[model samples]
Target: MFTLIYITASSVDESASIGRKLVEERLAACVNIIPSIRSIYHWEGSMEEDEESALIVKTSHELTPQIIKRVRELHSYDNPCIISIPITGGSRDYLEWLDDEVKRP
Candidate 1:
Protein backbone atom coordinates (compact mmCIF):
# COMPACT_ATOMS: atom_id res chain seq x y z
CA MET A 1 0.00 0.00 0.00
CA PHE A 2 0.99 3.59 -0.76
CA THR A 3 -0.12 7.07 0.15
CA LEU A 4 0.39 10.66 -0.90
CA ILE A 5 0.72 12.80 2.20
CA TYR A 6 -0.17 16.46 1.80
CA ILE A 7 1.02 19.06 4.26
CA THR A 8 1.01 22.85 4.17
CA ALA A 9 3.62 24.93 5.96
CA SER A 10 4.09 28.63 6.58
CA SER A 11 7.20 29.19 4.41
CA VAL A 12 9.25 27.77 1.60
CA ASP A 13 12.26 27.15 3.81
CA GLU A 14 10.16 25.26 6.33
CA SER A 15 8.59 23.18 3.60
CA ALA A 16 11.96 22.40 2.12
CA SER A 17 13.34 21.48 5.51
CA ILE A 18 10.48 19.07 6.11
CA GLY A 19 10.99 17.54 2.68
CA ARG A 20 14.72 17.17 3.23
CA LYS A 21 14.27 15.55 6.63
CA LEU A 22 11.73 13.08 5.31
CA VAL A 23 14.01 12.03 2.47
CA GLU A 24 17.12 11.95 4.64
CA GLU A 25 15.41 9.76 7.23
CA ARG A 26 14.08 7.41 4.55
CA LEU A 27 10.51 8.19 5.56
CA ALA A 28 9.46 9.39 2.16
CA ALA A 29 10.37 8.41 -1.38
CA CYS A 30 9.92 11.92 -2.78
CA VAL A 31 8.59 15.31 -1.82
CA ASN A 32 7.49 18.13 -4.11
CA ILE A 33 7.36 21.62 -2.68
CA ILE A 34 4.82 24.03 -4.08
CA PRO A 35 5.40 27.52 -2.80
CA SER A 36 3.31 30.66 -2.33
CA ILE A 37 0.00 28.95 -1.88
CA ARG A 38 -2.83 31.29 -0.92
CA SER A 39 -4.95 29.92 1.93
CA ILE A 40 -8.21 31.34 3.31
CA TYR A 41 -9.94 30.03 6.38
CA HIS A 42 -11.69 30.94 9.62
CA TRP A 43 -9.38 31.44 12.55
CA GLU A 44 -9.94 32.85 16.03
CA GLY A 45 -13.57 33.51 15.24
CA SER A 46 -12.68 35.55 12.16
CA MET A 47 -12.00 34.95 8.51
CA GLU A 48 -8.28 35.03 7.89
CA GLU A 49 -6.01 34.50 4.93
CA ASP A 50 -2.31 33.82 4.43
CA GLU A 51 0.33 32.48 2.11
CA GLU A 52 1.80 29.01 2.59
CA SER A 53 3.80 26.27 0.93
CA ALA A 54 2.44 22.83 0.16
CA LEU A 55 4.48 19.65 0.42
CA ILE A 56 3.41 16.61 -1.53
CA VAL A 57 5.03 13.55 0.06
CA LYS A 58 5.17 10.10 -1.46
CA THR A 59 5.71 7.11 0.84
CA SER A 60 4.31 3.86 2.13
CA HIS A 61 0.97 3.84 3.97
CA GLU A 62 2.59 2.36 7.05
CA LEU A 63 4.94 5.34 7.27
CA THR A 64 2.23 7.97 7.27
CA PRO A 65 1.97 8.12 11.09
CA GLN A 66 5.69 8.62 11.47
CA ILE A 67 5.67 11.28 8.79
CA ILE A 68 2.82 13.09 10.48
CA LYS A 69 4.56 12.92 13.85
CA ARG A 70 7.75 14.38 12.43
CA VAL A 71 5.88 17.12 10.63
CA ARG A 72 4.11 18.10 13.84
CA GLU A 73 7.39 18.20 15.72
CA LEU A 74 9.01 20.44 13.10
CA HIS A 75 6.03 22.57 12.05
CA SER A 76 5.56 26.17 13.11
CA TYR A 77 1.80 26.22 12.91
CA ASP A 78 -0.27 25.22 15.93
CA ASN A 79 -2.54 23.40 13.49
CA PRO A 80 -0.68 22.34 10.42
CA CYS A 81 -2.47 20.61 7.60
CA ILE A 82 -1.38 16.99 7.43
CA ILE A 83 -3.64 14.99 5.21
CA SER A 84 -3.05 11.64 3.51
CA ILE A 85 -4.98 10.30 0.60
CA PRO A 86 -4.50 6.70 -0.46
CA ILE A 87 -3.00 6.24 -3.90
CA THR A 88 -5.56 4.19 -5.72
CA GLY A 89 -3.43 3.85 -8.81
CA GLY A 90 -0.29 5.05 -10.61
CA SER A 91 2.29 4.06 -13.19
CA ARG A 92 3.76 0.68 -12.33
CA ASP A 93 7.36 1.77 -12.85
CA TYR A 94 6.92 4.93 -10.78
CA LEU A 95 5.16 3.05 -8.01
CA GLU A 96 7.93 0.46 -8.03
CA TRP A 97 10.48 3.20 -7.76
CA LEU A 98 8.56 4.72 -4.86
CA ASP A 99 8.46 1.34 -3.15
CA ASP A 100 12.20 0.93 -3.52
CA GLU A 101 12.93 4.42 -2.22
CA VAL A 102 10.90 4.17 1.00
CA LYS A 103 11.49 0.59 2.04
CA ARG A 104 11.88 0.29 5.81
CA PRO A 105 14.54 -1.93 7.32
Candidate 2:
Protein backbone atom coordinates (compact mmCIF):
# COMPACT_ATOMS: atom_id res chain seq x y z
CA MET A 1 0.00 0.00 0.00
CA PHE A 2 2.66 2.43 -1.03
CA THR A 3 1.85 5.88 -2.37
CA LEU A 4 3.42 9.06 -3.67
CA ILE A 5 2.01 12.37 -2.48
CA TYR A 6 2.54 15.45 -4.60
CA ILE A 7 2.25 18.89 -2.99
CA THR A 8 2.88 22.41 -4.23
CA ALA A 9 4.26 25.17 -2.02
CA SER A 10 4.80 28.88 -2.47
CA SER A 11 8.59 28.57 -2.16
CA VAL A 12 11.45 26.15 -1.73
CA ASP A 13 11.83 27.04 1.93
CA GLU A 14 8.20 26.34 2.67
CA SER A 15 8.31 23.05 0.79
CA ALA A 16 11.51 22.12 2.57
CA SER A 17 9.96 22.93 5.92
CA ILE A 18 6.93 20.78 5.23
CA GLY A 19 9.07 17.97 3.87
CA ARG A 20 11.33 18.07 6.90
CA LYS A 21 8.33 17.95 9.23
CA LEU A 22 6.85 14.97 7.44
CA VAL A 23 10.10 13.03 7.60
CA GLU A 24 10.80 14.02 11.18
CA GLU A 25 7.30 13.08 12.23
CA ARG A 26 7.72 9.66 10.56
CA LEU A 27 4.75 10.39 8.32
CA ALA A 28 6.84 10.06 5.18
CA ALA A 29 9.74 7.85 4.14
CA CYS A 30 11.37 10.31 1.75
CA VAL A 31 10.62 13.65 0.14
CA ASN A 32 11.97 15.09 -3.11
CA ILE A 33 11.73 18.85 -3.43
CA ILE A 34 11.75 20.53 -6.81
CA PRO A 35 13.10 23.99 -6.12
CA SER A 36 11.42 25.88 -8.90
CA ILE A 37 8.44 25.22 -11.12
CA ARG A 38 6.09 27.39 -13.16
CA SER A 39 2.39 26.86 -12.57
CA ILE A 40 -0.48 28.30 -14.56
CA TYR A 41 -4.07 27.83 -13.56
CA HIS A 42 -7.43 29.49 -12.96
CA TRP A 43 -8.08 31.01 -9.56
CA GLU A 44 -11.04 33.09 -8.48
CA GLY A 45 -12.23 33.15 -12.11
CA SER A 46 -8.94 34.54 -13.34
CA MET A 47 -5.91 32.95 -14.94
CA GLU A 48 -2.91 33.08 -12.67
CA GLU A 49 0.70 32.06 -13.03
CA ASP A 50 3.43 31.77 -10.47
CA GLU A 51 6.70 30.13 -9.54
CA GLU A 52 6.40 27.42 -6.93
CA SER A 53 8.08 24.40 -5.45
CA ALA A 54 6.92 20.82 -5.72
CA LEU A 55 7.30 18.16 -3.07
CA ILE A 56 7.10 14.45 -3.76
CA VAL A 57 6.48 12.34 -0.68
CA LYS A 58 7.01 8.61 -0.51
CA THR A 59 5.17 6.67 2.16
CA SER A 60 2.38 4.18 2.85
CA HIS A 61 -1.21 4.65 1.79
CA GLU A 62 -2.29 4.55 5.41
CA LEU A 63 -0.35 7.72 6.06
CA THR A 64 -1.84 9.74 3.23
CA PRO A 65 -4.60 11.27 5.32
CA GLN A 66 -2.27 12.42 8.02
CA ILE A 67 0.13 13.76 5.42
CA ILE A 68 -2.62 15.78 3.80
CA LYS A 69 -3.75 17.14 7.13
CA ARG A 70 -0.23 18.09 8.15
CA VAL A 71 0.48 19.78 4.85
CA ARG A 72 -2.70 21.80 5.11
CA GLU A 73 -1.70 23.00 8.54
CA LEU A 74 1.64 24.24 7.21
CA HIS A 75 0.55 25.43 3.77
CA SER A 76 -0.12 29.03 2.87
CA TYR A 77 -2.64 28.56 0.08
CA ASP A 78 -6.35 28.68 0.76
CA ASN A 79 -6.57 25.44 -1.17
CA PRO A 80 -3.20 23.77 -1.46
CA CYS A 81 -2.55 21.13 -4.08
CA ILE A 82 -2.07 17.78 -2.37
CA ILE A 83 -2.67 14.67 -4.36
CA SER A 84 -1.74 11.05 -3.82
CA ILE A 85 -0.82 8.49 -6.45
CA PRO A 86 -0.70 4.77 -5.81
CA ILE A 87 2.60 2.98 -6.33
CA THR A 88 1.50 -0.09 -8.20
CA GLY A 89 5.00 -1.12 -9.25
CA GLY A 90 8.59 -0.45 -8.36
CA SER A 91 11.83 -2.08 -7.23
CA ARG A 92 11.06 -4.49 -4.42
CA ASP A 93 14.11 -3.49 -2.40
CA TYR A 94 13.35 0.20 -2.59
CA LEU A 95 9.72 -0.35 -1.77
CA GLU A 96 10.68 -2.42 1.21
CA TRP A 97 13.01 0.34 2.29
CA LEU A 98 10.18 2.83 2.00
CA ASP A 99 8.05 0.65 4.24
CA ASP A 100 10.86 0.43 6.72
CA GLU A 101 11.37 4.16 6.86
CA VAL A 102 7.76 5.20 7.39
CA LYS A 103 5.79 4.21 10.45
CA ARG A 104 3.02 1.71 9.92
CA PRO A 105 -0.44 2.98 10.76
Candidate 3:
Protein backbone atom coordinates (compact mmCIF):
# COMPACT_ATOMS: atom_id res chain seq x y z
CA MET A 1 0.00 0.00 0.00
CA PHE A 2 1.17 3.51 -0.81
CA THR A 3 0.55 6.81 0.93
CA LEU A 4 1.15 10.52 0.54
CA ILE A 5 2.50 12.07 3.66
CA TYR A 6 2.22 15.82 4.11
CA ILE A 7 4.34 17.75 6.56
CA THR A 8 5.02 21.43 7.12
CA ALA A 9 8.42 22.57 8.33
CA SER A 10 9.43 25.87 9.85
CA SER A 11 12.25 26.50 7.39
CA VAL A 12 13.56 25.49 4.02
CA ASP A 13 16.73 24.00 5.48
CA GLU A 14 14.76 21.74 7.80
CA SER A 15 12.58 20.57 4.94
CA ALA A 16 15.55 19.81 2.76
CA SER A 17 17.37 18.06 5.56
CA ILE A 18 14.39 15.84 6.31
CA GLY A 19 13.84 15.13 2.65
CA ARG A 20 17.43 14.03 2.19
CA LYS A 21 17.32 11.82 5.26
CA LEU A 22 14.12 10.07 4.20
CA VAL A 23 15.31 9.44 0.65
CA GLU A 24 18.69 8.21 1.90
CA GLU A 25 17.03 5.81 4.32
CA ARG A 26 14.56 4.58 1.68
CA LEU A 27 11.74 5.73 3.87
CA ALA A 28 10.40 7.89 1.07
CA ALA A 29 10.45 7.46 -2.69
CA CYS A 30 10.27 11.18 -3.37
CA VAL A 31 9.73 14.48 -1.58
CA ASN A 32 8.49 17.67 -3.16
CA ILE A 33 9.55 20.80 -1.35
CA ILE A 34 7.30 23.80 -1.65
CA PRO A 35 8.63 27.02 -0.22
CA SER A 36 7.15 30.31 0.97
CA ILE A 37 3.82 28.91 2.07
CA ARG A 38 1.79 31.24 4.26
CA SER A 39 0.05 29.55 7.16
CA ILE A 40 -2.46 31.12 9.53
CA TYR A 41 -3.62 29.32 12.61
CA HIS A 42 -4.58 29.80 16.24
CA TRP A 43 -1.86 29.09 18.76
CA GLU A 44 -1.90 29.67 22.49
CA GLY A 45 -5.24 31.49 22.21
CA SER A 46 -3.85 33.84 19.61
CA MET A 47 -4.03 33.90 15.84
CA GLU A 48 -0.61 33.77 14.22
CA GLU A 49 0.73 33.60 10.72
CA ASP A 50 4.06 32.48 9.40
CA GLU A 51 5.91 31.50 6.29
CA GLU A 52 6.60 27.79 6.04
CA SER A 53 7.69 25.10 3.65
CA ALA A 54 5.58 22.12 2.77
CA LEU A 55 7.01 18.69 2.13
CA ILE A 56 4.99 16.22 0.12
CA VAL A 57 6.45 12.77 0.69
CA LYS A 58 5.68 9.69 -1.31
CA THR A 59 6.23 6.41 0.45
CA SER A 60 4.65 3.12 1.45
CA HIS A 61 2.17 2.73 4.26
CA GLU A 62 4.51 0.27 5.97
CA LEU A 63 6.99 3.10 6.47
CA THR A 64 4.59 5.77 7.70
CA PRO A 65 5.20 5.22 11.39
CA GLN A 66 8.95 5.36 11.06
CA ILE A 67 8.72 8.42 8.85
CA ILE A 68 6.51 10.22 11.33
CA LYS A 69 8.81 9.36 14.19
CA ARG A 70 11.85 10.67 12.37
CA VAL A 71 10.10 13.85 11.36
CA ARG A 72 9.10 14.53 14.95
CA GLU A 73 12.61 13.89 16.15
CA LEU A 74 14.08 16.35 13.66
CA HIS A 75 11.29 18.93 13.57
CA SER A 76 11.73 22.31 15.26
CA TYR A 77 8.10 23.07 15.99
CA ASP A 78 6.53 22.08 19.26
CA ASN A 79 3.71 20.47 17.30
CA PRO A 80 4.65 19.89 13.73
CA CYS A 81 2.18 18.92 11.04
CA ILE A 82 2.46 15.27 9.96
CA ILE A 83 -0.45 13.78 8.08
CA SER A 84 -0.76 10.80 5.76
CA ILE A 85 -3.30 10.23 3.06
CA PRO A 86 -3.73 6.79 1.52
CA ILE A 87 -3.14 6.56 -2.20
CA THR A 88 -6.18 4.89 -3.68
CA GLY A 89 -5.17 5.00 -7.36
CA GLY A 90 -2.25 5.67 -9.64
CA SER A 91 -0.55 4.50 -12.81
CA ARG A 92 0.74 0.94 -12.45
CA ASP A 93 4.19 1.75 -13.76
CA TYR A 94 4.57 4.83 -11.57
CA LEU A 95 3.39 2.89 -8.56
CA GLU A 96 5.87 0.15 -9.34
CA TRP A 97 8.61 2.72 -9.57
CA LEU A 98 7.65 4.19 -6.26
CA ASP A 99 7.76 0.76 -4.70
CA ASP A 100 11.19 0.06 -6.13
CA GLU A 101 12.57 3.39 -4.93
CA VAL A 102 11.56 2.70 -1.34
CA LYS A 103 12.54 -0.92 -1.17
CA ARG A 104 15.29 -2.05 1.21
CA PRO A 105 18.39 -3.64 -0.23
Candidate 4:
Protein backbone atom coordinates (compact mmCIF):
# COMPACT_ATOMS: atom_id res chain seq x y z
CA MET A 1 0.00 0.00 0.00
CA PHE A 2 1.04 3.57 -0.76
CA THR A 3 0.56 6.62 1.44
CA LEU A 4 0.92 10.37 1.40
CA ILE A 5 2.15 12.08 4.56
CA TYR A 6 1.23 15.74 5.00
CA ILE A 7 3.53 17.59 7.37
CA THR A 8 3.60 21.27 8.27
CA ALA A 9 6.93 22.89 9.02
CA SER A 10 8.05 26.25 10.35
CA SER A 11 9.71 27.30 7.09
CA VAL A 12 10.63 26.25 3.60
CA ASP A 13 14.23 25.51 4.57
CA GLU A 14 13.18 23.25 7.40
CA SER A 15 10.70 21.48 5.17
CA ALA A 16 13.31 21.00 2.49
CA SER A 17 15.79 19.62 5.02
CA ILE A 18 13.34 17.07 6.35
CA GLY A 19 12.15 16.11 2.89
CA ARG A 20 15.65 15.65 1.58
CA LYS A 21 16.63 13.47 4.53
CA LEU A 22 13.63 11.23 4.05
CA VAL A 23 14.33 10.77 0.34
CA GLU A 24 18.02 10.22 0.89
CA GLU A 25 17.35 7.57 3.51
CA ARG A 26 14.81 5.86 1.22
CA LEU A 27 12.03 6.45 3.74
CA ALA A 28 10.17 8.36 1.07
CA ALA A 29 10.06 8.08 -2.69
CA CYS A 30 9.41 11.80 -3.26
CA VAL A 31 8.45 14.96 -1.44
CA ASN A 32 6.58 18.04 -2.59
CA ILE A 33 7.17 21.19 -0.60
CA ILE A 34 4.83 24.15 -0.65
CA PRO A 35 6.92 27.15 0.27
CA SER A 36 4.20 29.12 1.92
CA ILE A 37 0.85 28.52 3.51
CA ARG A 38 -1.37 30.26 6.06
CA SER A 39 -2.36 28.17 9.05
CA ILE A 40 -4.85 28.78 11.86
CA TYR A 41 -5.34 26.50 14.79
CA HIS A 42 -5.67 26.22 18.55
CA TRP A 43 -2.73 25.29 20.68
CA GLU A 44 -2.28 25.19 24.47
CA GLY A 45 -5.73 26.74 24.85
CA SER A 46 -4.85 29.61 22.58
CA MET A 47 -5.75 30.35 18.99
CA GLU A 48 -2.80 31.00 16.74
CA GLU A 49 -1.99 31.83 13.13
CA ASP A 50 1.22 31.54 11.22
CA GLU A 51 2.86 31.14 7.86
CA GLU A 52 4.24 27.67 7.29
CA SER A 53 5.46 25.27 4.66
CA ALA A 54 3.64 22.10 3.78
CA LEU A 55 5.53 18.93 2.97
CA ILE A 56 3.81 16.14 1.12
CA VAL A 57 5.70 12.85 1.20
CA LYS A 58 5.01 9.86 -1.01
CA THR A 59 6.01 6.43 0.27
CA SER A 60 4.72 3.02 1.25
CA HIS A 61 2.55 2.11 4.20
CA GLU A 62 5.34 0.14 5.83
CA LEU A 63 7.50 3.25 6.06
CA THR A 64 4.93 5.53 7.62
CA PRO A 65 5.89 4.83 11.25
CA GLN A 66 9.57 5.43 10.71
CA ILE A 67 8.81 8.58 8.72
CA ILE A 68 6.75 10.01 11.55
CA LYS A 69 9.41 9.18 14.13
CA ARG A 70 12.16 10.74 12.03
CA VAL A 71 10.11 13.83 11.35
CA ARG A 72 9.47 14.32 15.05
CA GLU A 73 13.15 14.05 15.77
CA LEU A 74 13.92 16.70 13.14
CA HIS A 75 10.97 18.98 13.73
CA SER A 76 10.97 22.19 15.72
CA TYR A 77 7.45 22.23 17.05
CA ASP A 78 6.58 20.24 20.15
CA ASN A 79 3.59 18.75 18.37
CA PRO A 80 4.11 19.00 14.66
CA CYS A 81 1.33 18.32 12.24
CA ILE A 82 1.99 15.01 10.54
CA ILE A 83 -0.93 13.26 8.97
CA SER A 84 -0.92 10.27 6.65
CA ILE A 85 -3.53 9.50 4.05
CA PRO A 86 -3.79 6.27 2.13
CA ILE A 87 -3.52 6.44 -1.64
CA THR A 88 -6.39 4.28 -2.69
CA GLY A 89 -5.87 4.79 -6.42
CA GLY A 90 -3.46 6.36 -8.86
CA SER A 91 -1.64 5.83 -12.13
CA ARG A 92 -0.14 2.37 -12.20
CA ASP A 93 3.13 3.52 -13.74
CA TYR A 94 3.62 6.22 -11.11
CA LEU A 95 2.79 3.88 -8.26
CA GLU A 96 5.21 1.31 -9.61
CA TRP A 97 7.88 3.95 -9.90
CA LEU A 98 7.28 5.06 -6.33
CA ASP A 99 7.58 1.50 -5.16
CA ASP A 100 10.88 1.21 -6.93
CA GLU A 101 12.24 4.42 -5.37
CA VAL A 102 11.54 3.40 -1.76
CA LYS A 103 12.92 0.43 0.11
CA ARG A 104 10.63 -2.51 0.73
CA PRO A 105 10.19 -4.07 4.16
Candidate 5:
Protein backbone atom coordinates (compact mmCIF):
# COMPACT_ATOMS: atom_id res chain seq x y z
CA MET A 1 0.00 0.00 0.00
CA PHE A 2 1.11 3.54 -0.79
CA THR A 3 -0.07 6.96 0.29
CA LEU A 4 0.51 10.61 -0.49
CA ILE A 5 0.47 12.51 2.77
CA TYR A 6 -0.51 16.17 2.79
CA ILE A 7 0.88 18.47 5.45
CA THR A 8 0.96 22.23 5.94
CA ALA A 9 3.82 24.09 7.60
CA SER A 10 4.42 27.60 8.86
CA SER A 11 7.39 28.19 6.58
CA VAL A 12 9.89 26.75 4.13
CA ASP A 13 12.37 26.04 6.90
CA GLU A 14 9.83 24.06 8.86
CA SER A 15 8.79 22.24 5.69
CA ALA A 16 12.39 21.36 4.99
CA SER A 17 12.88 20.20 8.55
CA ILE A 18 9.87 17.93 8.43
CA GLY A 19 10.85 16.55 5.02
CA ARG A 20 14.43 15.96 6.11
CA LYS A 21 13.42 14.08 9.23
CA LEU A 22 11.02 11.83 7.36
CA VAL A 23 13.58 10.99 4.67
CA GLU A 24 16.44 10.54 7.13
CA GLU A 25 14.38 8.09 9.17
CA ARG A 26 13.11 6.30 6.05
CA LEU A 27 9.53 7.07 7.04
CA ALA A 28 8.90 8.68 3.64
CA ALA A 29 10.30 7.83 0.23
CA CYS A 30 10.19 11.47 -0.82
CA VAL A 31 8.83 14.84 0.27
CA ASN A 32 8.00 17.67 -2.11
CA ILE A 33 7.88 21.18 -0.70
CA ILE A 34 5.76 23.90 -2.16
CA PRO A 35 7.42 26.97 -0.75
CA SER A 36 4.56 29.41 -0.74
CA ILE A 37 0.79 29.09 -0.84
CA ARG A 38 -2.31 30.71 0.53
CA SER A 39 -4.44 28.78 2.95
CA ILE A 40 -7.97 29.55 4.17
CA TYR A 41 -9.86 27.59 6.75
CA HIS A 42 -11.63 27.62 10.09
CA TRP A 43 -9.53 27.68 13.22
CA GLU A 44 -10.38 28.31 16.88
CA GLY A 45 -13.98 29.04 15.98
CA SER A 46 -13.16 31.57 13.26
CA MET A 47 -12.14 31.60 9.58
CA GLU A 48 -8.55 32.50 8.91
CA GLU A 49 -6.16 32.87 5.99
CA ASP A 50 -2.39 32.76 5.83
CA GLU A 51 0.64 32.04 3.70
CA GLU A 52 2.05 28.55 4.33
CA SER A 53 4.29 25.90 2.91
CA ALA A 54 2.90 22.58 1.79
CA LEU A 55 4.59 19.20 2.06
CA ILE A 56 3.67 16.37 -0.23
CA VAL A 57 4.98 13.23 1.47
CA LYS A 58 5.28 9.92 -0.24
CA THR A 59 5.52 6.70 1.74
CA SER A 60 4.01 3.31 2.40
CA HIS A 61 0.87 2.77 4.44
CA GLU A 62 2.78 0.78 7.08
CA LEU A 63 4.86 3.80 8.11
CA THR A 64 1.99 6.26 8.61
CA PRO A 65 1.91 5.92 12.40
CA GLN A 66 5.60 6.62 12.78
CA ILE A 67 5.45 9.45 10.27
CA ILE A 68 2.55 11.09 12.06
CA LYS A 69 4.29 10.75 15.41
CA ARG A 70 7.53 12.26 14.15
CA VAL A 71 5.73 15.07 12.31
CA ARG A 72 3.76 16.07 15.42
CA GLU A 73 6.93 15.95 17.48
CA LEU A 74 8.58 18.45 15.15
CA HIS A 75 5.61 20.55 14.01
CA SER A 76 5.06 24.08 15.34
CA TYR A 77 1.28 24.08 15.16
CA ASP A 78 -0.89 22.89 18.03
CA ASN A 79 -2.84 20.90 15.43
CA PRO A 80 -1.17 20.55 12.05
CA CYS A 81 -2.92 19.01 9.10
CA ILE A 82 -1.65 15.49 8.36
CA ILE A 83 -3.93 13.80 5.91
CA SER A 84 -3.26 10.75 3.73
CA ILE A 85 -4.80 9.79 0.43
CA PRO A 86 -4.54 6.35 -1.18
CA ILE A 87 -2.47 5.92 -4.32
CA THR A 88 -4.61 3.74 -6.52
CA GLY A 89 -2.35 3.86 -9.57
CA GLY A 90 1.13 4.96 -10.54
CA SER A 91 4.11 4.09 -12.72
CA ARG A 92 5.45 0.63 -11.92
CA ASP A 93 9.11 1.64 -11.76
CA TYR A 94 8.40 4.69 -9.62
CA LEU A 95 6.16 2.72 -7.29
CA GLU A 96 8.81 0.01 -6.98
CA TRP A 97 11.40 2.60 -6.14
CA LEU A 98 9.08 4.05 -3.53
CA ASP A 99 8.65 0.60 -1.96
CA ASP A 100 12.41 0.02 -1.93
CA GLU A 101 13.04 3.41 -0.39
CA VAL A 102 10.59 2.97 2.50
CA LYS A 103 10.96 -0.72 3.26
CA ARG A 104 10.00 -1.63 6.83
CA PRO A 105 12.73 -2.77 9.19
Candidate 6:
Protein backbone atom coordinates (compact mmCIF):
# COMPACT_ATOMS: atom_id res chain seq x y z
CA MET A 1 0.00 0.00 0.00
CA PHE A 2 1.07 3.57 -0.61
CA THR A 3 0.78 6.56 1.70
CA LEU A 4 0.63 10.33 1.45
CA ILE A 5 2.39 12.07 4.32
CA TYR A 6 1.41 15.66 5.09
CA ILE A 7 3.92 17.79 6.94
CA THR A 8 4.07 21.50 7.79
CA ALA A 9 7.37 23.29 8.11
CA SER A 10 8.37 26.75 9.30
CA SER A 11 9.64 27.91 5.93
CA VAL A 12 10.04 26.99 2.29
CA ASP A 13 13.73 26.30 2.75
CA GLU A 14 13.06 23.97 5.64
CA SER A 15 10.31 22.14 3.79
CA ALA A 16 12.43 21.70 0.69
CA SER A 17 15.39 20.57 2.78
CA ILE A 18 13.35 17.89 4.53
CA GLY A 19 11.88 16.78 1.21
CA ARG A 20 15.31 16.46 -0.32
CA LYS A 21 16.59 14.45 2.61
CA LEU A 22 13.67 12.06 2.49
CA VAL A 23 14.05 11.51 -1.24
CA GLU A 24 17.81 11.15 -1.04
CA GLU A 25 17.47 8.51 1.68
CA ARG A 26 14.76 6.62 -0.27
CA LEU A 27 12.35 7.13 2.58
CA ALA A 28 9.99 9.02 0.25
CA ALA A 29 9.41 8.75 -3.46
CA CYS A 30 8.29 12.35 -4.05
CA VAL A 31 7.48 15.47 -2.08
CA ASN A 32 5.37 18.39 -3.31
CA ILE A 33 6.09 21.54 -1.37
CA ILE A 34 3.60 24.38 -1.09
CA PRO A 35 5.62 27.54 -0.54
CA SER A 36 3.04 29.69 1.14
CA ILE A 37 0.31 28.61 3.46
CA ARG A 38 -1.52 30.45 6.21
CA SER A 39 -1.96 28.13 9.16
CA ILE A 40 -4.11 28.79 12.20
CA TYR A 41 -4.34 26.37 15.05
CA HIS A 42 -4.22 26.09 18.79
CA TRP A 43 -0.90 25.65 20.53
CA GLU A 44 0.00 25.46 24.19
CA GLY A 45 -2.69 27.61 25.76
CA SER A 46 -3.59 29.95 22.91
CA MET A 47 -4.48 30.15 19.26
CA GLU A 48 -1.60 30.54 16.88
CA GLU A 49 -1.41 31.66 13.29
CA ASP A 50 1.57 31.71 10.99
CA GLU A 51 2.71 31.41 7.42
CA GLU A 52 4.16 27.98 6.77
CA SER A 53 5.15 25.62 4.03
CA ALA A 54 3.32 22.35 3.53
CA LEU A 55 4.84 19.20 2.14
CA ILE A 56 2.93 16.35 0.58
CA VAL A 57 5.14 13.27 0.63
CA LYS A 58 4.58 10.02 -1.17
CA THR A 59 5.95 6.65 -0.02
CA SER A 60 5.00 3.13 0.89
CA HIS A 61 2.91 2.48 3.97
CA GLU A 62 5.68 0.35 5.42
CA LEU A 63 8.01 3.32 5.48
CA THR A 64 5.75 5.54 7.57
CA PRO A 65 7.68 5.10 10.80
CA GLN A 66 11.02 5.77 9.20
CA ILE A 67 9.69 8.85 7.43
CA ILE A 68 8.26 10.23 10.66
CA LYS A 69 11.53 9.64 12.48
CA ARG A 70 13.56 11.33 9.79
CA VAL A 71 11.17 14.30 9.56
CA ARG A 72 11.45 14.90 13.28
CA GLU A 73 15.20 14.74 13.13
CA LEU A 74 15.35 17.36 10.38
CA HIS A 75 12.37 19.54 11.33
CA SER A 76 13.02 22.80 13.20
CA TYR A 77 9.73 22.92 15.05
CA ASP A 78 9.69 21.26 18.46
CA ASN A 79 6.39 19.60 17.52
CA PRO A 80 5.89 19.56 13.79
CA CYS A 81 2.78 18.38 12.01
CA ILE A 82 3.38 15.06 10.29
CA ILE A 83 0.28 13.19 9.28
CA SER A 84 -0.10 10.24 6.91
CA ILE A 85 -3.08 9.20 4.86
CA PRO A 86 -3.36 6.02 2.77
CA ILE A 87 -3.21 6.41 -1.00
CA THR A 88 -6.00 4.14 -2.09
CA GLY A 89 -5.64 4.78 -5.80
CA GLY A 90 -3.58 6.59 -8.41
CA SER A 91 -2.32 6.20 -11.97
CA ARG A 92 -0.65 2.82 -12.48
CA ASP A 93 2.54 4.09 -14.03
CA TYR A 94 2.95 6.85 -11.50
CA LEU A 95 2.36 4.44 -8.64
CA GLU A 96 4.94 2.04 -10.07
CA TRP A 97 7.44 4.85 -10.36
CA LEU A 98 6.76 5.89 -6.80
CA ASP A 99 7.44 2.32 -5.67
CA ASP A 100 10.71 2.17 -7.57
CA GLU A 101 11.85 5.53 -6.25
CA VAL A 102 11.67 4.43 -2.64
CA LYS A 103 12.72 0.82 -3.06
CA ARG A 104 15.56 -0.23 -0.79
CA PRO A 105 18.68 -1.64 -2.33
lDDT of 5: 0.94
Overall lDDT per candidate, in order of appearance: 0.93, 0.95, 0.92, 0.96, 0.94, 0.94
Per-residue lDDT tens digits for candidate 2, residues 10-86, read 99999999999999999999999999999999988999999999999999999999998989998898789999999
* Clashes per model (N, Cα, C within 3 A): 0, 0, 0, 0, 0, 0
Best by lDDT: 4
Residue-level lDDT of model 1, residues 25-71, one tens digit each, is: 99999999998799999998999999999999999999988998989
Write candidate 6's Cα lDDT for 1-105 as tens digits: 999999999999999999999999999999999999999998888999999999999999999989888899999988899999999998999999999999663
- My TM-score estimates for the predictions, one after another, are 0.95, 0.97, 0.94, 0.96, 0.95, 0.95
Model 3 pairs whose backbones collide? none
Report the alpha-carbon TM-score of model 2 versus the true structure: 0.97
After superposing candidate 3 on the true structure, give the runs of residues whose Cα lies further than 4 Å from its correct spot: none
lDDT of 6: 0.94
User: What are the runs in model 5 whose C-alpha is more than 4 Å off?
Assistant: none
Give the range of the ten consecutive residues with the poorest summed lDDT in model 2: 70-79
RMSD of 2: 0.7
Stretches of candidate 6 above 4 Å error?
A: none
Which 10 consecutive positions of candidate 6 have the poorest summed lDDT?
Answer: 96-105
Alpha-carbon RMSD, candidate 3: 1.5
Off by over 4 Å in 4: none
Q: 1-105, model 4: which lDDT tens digit per residue?
A: 999999999999999999999999999999999999999999889999999999999999999999999999999998899999999999999999999999876
RMSD of 4: 0.8
